[model samples]
Target: MIEKINLNNILFLDIETVPEEENFLSLDDDMKQLWEQKTQYQRCDEFTPEDFYDRAGIWAEFGKIVCISVGYFVNKGDIRNFRVTSFFGEEKKILKDFSNLLENHFNQAQHVLCGHNAKEFDIPFIARRMIINQIAIPNKLNLFGKKPWEIPHLDTLELWKFGDYKHFTSLKLLTKILGIPSPKGDIDGSQVAHVYYVEKDIDRIVIYCEKDVIAVAQIFLRLRREELLIEDEIIHV
Candidate 1:
């Protein structure tokens, strides 16, 4: 059996993504034709090398991080003190700085990295962007060769399965089920891109990302507490 891990080593993180640029909407003839055929939201109108630069611009304008919020909870014998940090600005620098901080300050003592849907989204996204910028990924996050189950990851969404993959659960729904107040506020995921693109408000994106991190953390805590009571009534009666 795998040994139980100390939660302190785990860093829970989430990121907010937006289209690279406004001008990316002006695509080449073939791409424009493809975009024109798709429905409004379904269109990939903002994808291009130029759009990547636009994303870089937003990253610079916001502080280099496109809104990455990480929550670290270390158990201090009796209680856990959760420290949350929001990273914004240039993707490369912010990622490098955070990687260094994690290695020098956090990685040495931790047992594992944890997040909600992190394996599918957050981790790879950060790793790929780091590669794009030629920044080395922290050793703690270098999981390219690791086996899925063998990897030291604790995804609350995966834990919800409890080894039985029957139903799909979202963070919001899980939080609601556990009686944990949803931190989403008035902004949903669909609105995130628009808020970043139209409003150009980095603060809003930061707040939104922080809320998601908190929600994921809460879900983890609730699961640990065995507070995830299945609503059998909703399914059986």
Candidate 2:
């Protein structure tokens, strides 16, 4: 079934996010209380809400997307190329630009969205943020009322699970085990918030995000028993 789907019809992507505010103290009194309540179970007397604030980016209500990087396949005859691009800047603009890309170019019923663990994280995060910013959700990301088989989304992490519901794998670990090149640089997801807030290095984050997109596409290729993408085949546009 995986080989039946045309690679060109899929848009592979990854996103980077950071907390809405730089620190706990920056939140208003009401939000502060809300944050505490939100994490009460997870914190469990081991750490205060402030200590757990760095992970706020994991939740749409308390964080904002900083970058969304996407890559799609372009196959012509014997040649195959993957074109990659990114949308970053103000959260609203990022969501708007990404939404437009989906609505305009990838709006076909056959078009699908692919990401690592995206079914649980990336897809919902984008939809939630778009709603918060009052942007209409793109057809590709809008899963409302769609039957399970009718949904046009694929998750590499879920694929790797292979019916093992308890199994979990990180992109980095999966890539290593599958022999795909590692995407990690000097920074990782844990450091993205600090890079965006303190170092003010969005460019670095964009590069990281793009790398993840490429890695995802490569992972799909591997899953289909195809060759991994050579560096020369990856184009950053």
Candidate 3:
């Protein structure tokens, strides 16, 4: 049944994001209140352009994405053929180009978007940036408002939940639990912004993103196999 879902009809993606620059923050009082309450990070004491810039700098210097990697896996008989591509450039340009590529390559109505923690971070981040850029948001990404189980979205983190909501798990930790080789070397997510800012090396960022994509693919394979084994055992028993 899983195989019948057409693996080619899925797009696996990941994104990196940074905070808005000080000049970028022209938030009204209401907007500032909402943002301070809703944002994942801490809020500033005052709402000045300088404070906003410092906030953005904090993200640019640490919290934001430096690269986004996308992977497509299509089942070819016994083999799962995968193609991994990375978009690394100025954040605005990369987001624009990447959005265009997705629109051109896949049919929004047909393909299921897949990612690890994408629903929470990647999708929203991309969508917000697209709005800021005045780019059309893809229909698939527009499903963010839908309930988790209602949407066609497949977050590996959510899938790992099975039936119970017990604990929150990171992708790296999940890889270890599933015996999947850790693709992240000594580099972790926290260091990504620094690497991109200080080294100004797009290649390193690309490599880091590519490794994450590979890690995601490996995790998907392991989960699929585990599910198959469980199904087969149930059938026999």
Candidate 4:
């Protein structure tokens, strides 16, 4: 199946998000209540809503996208280029820009959206965030009427599973086993909120997001038993 799909037609991507507010104390009464209720299932008895606030970025309702980095393959005769681009800033602006990119570039029958566990995380998160930002869903994201098989999403994690629903794999772990260089070095998903809130470093986050995007594509290539692209082959757009 991997060999049959055109790598050039897929948009490989990843996202970075943070809590809507830097601190729980910054949330209004209504938001506070909503967040507390939302985390009830996972929140431990000892931790208050404020204690769990740092994880808000994982939930679309309590979080906002800080960065969205995407890459796509372009075949040019003897050379192959994978161009990566990023959208970062205020959530509304990021969402709007990403939506426009999809609508203009990848909104076609031949284009498939691919990422590591994107179907469960990135895709739904982007769709929900776009809705919250009051932006119209792009053709690629508007999955309301599409049949199960009609959806064009291709998840590297899902592909790795090979129909084993009980198995789950992280991008980092998969890349390590596949002999691909680790996209994550010192920082990780858990530190994103702290980096954005405390360090105020969106650029760092964007770099990390782009690495994940590249890692996702590399993982897909690995699944097809193809050689991963070297750094020079990756172009930043």
Judged by TM-score, which candidate is best? Answer: 2
Q: Judging by lDDT, tell me the better candidate of 1 and 4.
A: 4
Worst 10 residues of 4 by lDDT: 38-47
Best by lDDT: 2
Residue by residue across 1-237, what tens digits does model 1's lDDT show? 112555566777788765444445555666445434432343256554443333332232211237788876655675446667887866666688778767786666345667777766677777777776788888777887977765656777778877766756888888888898777876876566667668877788787888777778777767667332222211110
Error of 4 at 36 (Å): 1.5
Stretches of candidate 3 exceeding 4 Å from the true structure:
1-4, 20-65, 144-150, 226-237
Q: Which segments of model 1 are wrong by more than 4 Å?
A: 1-3, 26-65, 164-167, 226-237
Error of 1 at 17 (Å): 0.9
Candidate 3 lDDT over residue span 165-233, tens digit each: 675789889888998767686566655545655566667767766767666766776767732112111
Model 1 clashing residue pairs (backbone) = 9-110, 63-89, 63-90, 64-89, 64-90, 65-88, 65-89, 65-90
**Mind giving the per-residue lDDT tens digits that candidate 2 earns over 1-237?**
889899999999999999999999999999999999999999999999999999999999999999999999999989999999999999999999999999999999999999999999999999999999999998888888999998899999999999898999999999999999999888999999999999999999999999999999989999999999998998889
Tens digit of per-residue lDDT, candidate 4, span 1-237: 779898889999899988989999999999999999988889869789999999999999998899999999998787988999999988899888988888888888989999998999999999999888889998888889899999989999898998999999999999999999999956899999999889988889999999999999899888898889999999998
The count of residue-pair clashes in candidate 2 stands at 0
The full ranking of all candidates by TM-score, starting with the best, is 2, 4, 1, 3
C-alpha TM-score for every candidate: 0.74, 0.99, 0.73, 0.97
| Alpha-carbon lDDT of model 4 | 0.91
**Model 2 TM-score, all chains together:** 0.99
- Candidate 2: deviation at residue 27, Å? 0.5
